[model samples]
Target: MNKSAHWIIYVAMLLAVLTVTVIVSLSVGEISIPFKDIFDIMADKESMEYGILAYIRIPRTLLGFAIGGSLSLAGAILQGIYRNPLVEPYTLGISGGASLGVTFAIVTGLHLLNIMFLPLAGFVGSFTTIFLVYTLSLRKGVLSVNRMLLTGVMISFIASSMMMFLMSITAVENIHGIVFWTMGSLNESNTTMIVSMIAIALISLVISYLFATPLNALRLGENKARHLGINSNITIRILFIITSLLTGVCIAVAGIIGFVGLVIPHITRLWVGSDYRILLITSFLSGSVFLIFCDIVARTIISPNELPIGVITGLIGGIAFIILLSGSRKNSRII
Candidate 1:
């Protein structure tokens, strides 16, 4: 089949999957509301299941989808800009910075003032780390990918160390909260948080989509991109800001969920080819579906005792990444 026809069919399938997944997620929560009752409750707010449907399941599902899409798109952008398939928010230390922020909030007792404060702190930490990494990686007016990677790794290590120190000094009772935030969860979802995440995810995705041509040029190589009249340096800088915003918001809302950013982009690339315009949209949809499915497994695998969403994504994404790496190596040897 032609690529365009294949894309149309693929997108239709994804939409179907997304619909089913949303319905199933809403229906299979703690109370086990029937699918019919779920629709009924949505139609009539006075229904008994209204609170659960509106206040709990809907927000949680939406937040999960938004966070997943944002992370995946951000990862796609980073991979394109850096010309490295393995680069992602988590690997590049953005998640570590956000984790440190959450840990700091827990240690400082800022979480007591308001639930929103944690994400705020996370954003601050993430942006700070982005700036630091970018500044450190610049050399003679050029952003060195190798230097950026090394700096990110070093910063991640430092952030992890700081987090461990905070954990050790924090009260035993507070340690669980810190650990949970780092692990990631969506149980605390609310309307305000969901709205904020949706806004950020949509805005960032739109902005990133507008730069798809430049990103495609960038993938060809910096000099080639500049020859095409694209300012490689400026493009990279703008990409960094957009990715930082998306990563920061995702971490703030959902904690340091790993692997979605790393795994989803590669998977989407395999399905849709490397065109950023198509890749971005497919990645967002695939990512949303992937995370929602993982979340379903996470919550239902142990019944009433829910596992952290990050744990599920990490386990699955880690395994998938290893397999992809092995396959890539085999292909290289064959070539």
Candidate 2:
């Protein structure tokens, strides 16, 4: 199929999946609201059902969608910039670093500072990791992809050790909360969190989308992109800022939902090729759909007792990654 035709199919599939997932999520929550009730609530918007639907499910579900989509979009930018298939949200240790911030806040009883402190600390950690990786990878003023990957791995290991130290110092009673947060949860979706995440995500997505052409030029390597009138440094700077912001905000709100960022972009690339224009749009929509569905499964699989959303996402994402890799290898041999 032509690129346009393939893109149309992928988008249509995403929309269909999104619609089904949203309905299933609303209907299958702990309260057992019926499917018809969900539709009626949505349609009428003034009834009692509407109040329950709007008040409870809508905000949380929307937050899940936003969190998933934002992380995936950030992943696309990261992968594009580094030209690496294995890079992911955890590569920069952002989520682990964020978890450490939260742990420190809890251990020290810094609840007042909790509002923005955790996220700020998370950003500091991630930027530190990024800079260290960049510095380590630079040799004679050029960044080596292998060095960057190695640096990220080493930094994550170090950050994770710091996180363990924080956890060990905390009291036993507070351990559960810290552990739960690290495992990841979407239980804290509120009006404030939703609004903040939406604003940040929308702005980042717009900026990333607008820079799609330059990103495409970037894929051709620094010298080639420079020859084509693209300033590689400026592009890298912009992408780092935007992707870091997206990653920071997401880890701040959702704790540490892993693998969606890594998983969704690769899937989108497979179905839509390397064009960031279509890849970006499709990744956002499809990532949201995937997360909501995973959440619904998380709630229903044990009923009354809910599993962590991160657990479900990681499990599904790991399996999906293997499948995609196997198929990619097969395709490569065929070509």
Q: What do the candidate models score in CA lDDT, each in turn? A: 0.86, 0.77
Question: Which ten-residue region of model 1 has the weakest summed lDDT?
Answer: 326-335
1-335 per-residue lDDT for model 1 (tens digits):
88788778877888898889888888886789888766667889887689888888888889878988899999999999888888998778888888898889989999899977988999888988998898999899888888999999999999999999999998999999988888888776567778988888888889988899999998789999999999999999889878987888888888888999889998888767888878888888888888888888899999889999999999999998777767866433311
Global local distance difference test of model 2: 0.77
Q: Worst lDDT window (10 residues) for model 2?
A: 326-335
Which stretches in model 1 have alpha-carbon errors above 4 Å?
328-335
RMSD of every prediction = 2.0, 3.0
Candidate 2, residues 233-265, lDDT tens digits: the string is 778767866787688778777778899899988
